[model samples]
Target: MSLLVTLAASTEELAPLLMPPLAFAGIAAAIFIALGFVVFSFRDVANRQGQGAGKSSDTHGSGH
Candidate 1:
């Protein structure tokens, strides 16, 4: 019981020092993943075609 109490106290004392960096890393990862999704969505749009004859929109009228 004494060891558990001491461990809890030590963890409490270190939590403040440890939490901010861990939180920032999680937020940064979320932002990076979101940005990647946005970029991929845009790329998909840019390379997309309308109603199909099997050609990309970007090559519609630029003389092949």
Candidate 2:
């Protein structure tokens, strides 16, 4: 019932939760979610600009 025993037991119970594979999986999931957000935002902006259907600006300063 000492402090050391309690801490040790807590750590033992929590050790598997911080293992490397689980940590990597969490990081990968986070990155994928972030990428999805970025892509979604880009598509939204393109749609708002009326360029969502593959149209692009071609009006360069050619002075023709």
Whole-model Cα lDDT of every candidate shown, in order: 0.72, 0.71
Candidate 1 C-alpha lDDT tens digits along 1-64: 9999887778444344645787989989999999999887787554454435446555677564
- Candidate 2's C-alpha runs over 4 A off are 1-19, 48-64
Choose the strongest candidate by lDDT.
Answer: 1
lDDT of 2 at 13: 42
Q: Between which residue pairs do clashes occur in model 1?
A: none
TM-scores for candidates 1 onward, in order: 0.41, 0.41
Q: Which ten residues in a row have the lowest lDDT in candidate 2?
A: 52-61
Tens digits of per-residue lDDT, candidate 2, 1-64, equal 6998887767444345556787899999999999999887787675567763333444543433
